[model samples]
Target: MAIEWKGIFPAFTTKFTAADELDLPLFGKNLQAQIAAGIDGVILGGSLGEASVITTAEKETLTKYAVEQVAGKIPVVMNIAEGATAEAIRQAKLAAAWGAKGLMLLPPMRYKSDERETAEYFKAVAASTELPIMIYNNPVDYKVEVTLAIFDQLQAYSNIQAVKESTRDVSNVTRMISRFGDRFSLLCGVDTLAMEEMILGANGWVGGLVCAFPAETVAIYKLTKAGRIAEALAIYRWFLPLLELDLHPKLVQYIKLAEQQAGLGSELVRAPRLALVGEERTRILKVIDSAIATRPVLPDYLSL
Candidate 1:
């Protein structure tokens, strides 16, 4: 199950029971929805998946479960957001053993590392596993920017194959293409920027809102790639408001709430992350409801 490094890859949310436990039944339903909608891959335990609060064992459980559930229809990628180099390596190996086909590697958590250190951390993790890696280059949230020079250093590792490009500057897509010439597959990590990045030649989208709006998300990606810009833009314009929810700090809860509205998941989150309340919940629900009310009938994008 080699990764194609192209198409819609959902940064899937981890479903939880009201008791704050893994809700595998709901999680499986969402995974099935994404698969049926034609996503290229599924990434578990990512930022939107609430990786920080999910224990290591729980991450492994998710990897094993996703691998079994997707069952080779698409790749299952586990996210590695460890604070320690050794722990990152350990998790990478465990993910591979758990049947994950790829990994989404984030910079060392908590401590912001310099260029050399960031490159070294990535190199160490890449070397620790045979699994293909997609570097999560999100300086806006992670604080450590994986600059081009760092990527130049990383080019030696063939398994460090792709990037979840979340720098928020759409120009970076052109910069990467101009510099690396596809040395690394670039996937738009920001949901709101997915259409822009894809048009700029990003290979795929690691979308957060796709957990709830899989069909619209996949249609936008397929439509963009098929040279149907106008059609893609139509849905993207309709999708913009819902997609903006991915940028919030409470993205896990926000997305899960969207999933609830979509009848795909629940809003239960782990400790330190309470469910949305007061004006926030009401406001977000309005956006979700609005989108649902006007949800477009998608074209047959798969035929493209």
Candidate 2:
């Protein structure tokens, strides 16, 4: 399966059984919905998926399950978040073994590395895997910015094809296109800025809230790219509040809560990560519910 690496690729949240185990059946259900909703691709073990707490075995299981459920209807890209080069390489091979079509490779997990070290980390991982890679660059969350200079050095690797741009600075989108000139495919990684990024020529979207609203997400991407600004803005304006949830630190909790409200999956998270409760829970739910109450009717083109 050749991943275009363009359009809506949900950084899908992982589903857990009430006992906090991998809920394969339930997770598969969500993956199927993403495909049926016409998303471009699906990503597993991402930040929204609680990658920090999930073990290697669990990640492999998630990768294999996504491969099985998607069944080549779309690409299942595995996300590799590791603390060392060797570990990142190991996991990249593991994803290849599980039949993942692509990899979303992040910088060193905890320790922030300098430009040289970070470029080397990505290079080493690229050397180890045959799978096409999308470098995850979330400076706000990860604290290590894969600056344009670092990305320039990365241009040497052919398989290091795309970037998940989460610098949170929309101007960076223009800078990437101007400097790289399509040398690299740039996917907008921030949900709130998806519209602005796409308008600025982001090749695709590495989305967070798409876990709950796949159709709306795809509609926004398709509409924007089609030059349907009026139609896109209608949806983007309505979606802005929910999209803001992705910017929150507890984005997993907020997104999972939205998924549950949207009847997609359970909000059960792993230990050390508890479900939302009391005021926080109510606050998030109010936002989701208000969106549901006044959700806009989909454009006919989107229904296709």
lDDT of 2 by residue, 1-304 (tens): 7668788899989899987889898888888888877888888888888998998889888888888887778898999899989988888888989889999999998898999999899999999878999999988889999999998988998888999999999999899899989989999999989999999999889988889988888888888888998999999999999999998889999999998999898888887889999999999999999998888887864543
- Assess candidate 1 and give its TM-score to the true structure: 0.99
Off by over 4 Å in 2: 302-304
Give the top-scoring candidate (lDDT). Answer: 1
User: Considering only N, C-alpha and C atoms within 3 Å, which residue pairs clash in candidate 1?
Assistant: none
Against the true structure, what is each candidate's TM-score?
A: 0.99, 0.98
RMSD of 2: 1.1
Query: Candidate 1: where is the Cα deviation over 4 Å?
Result: none
Candidate 1, poorest ten consecutive residues by summed lDDT: 12-21
Pairs of residues clashing in candidate 2: none
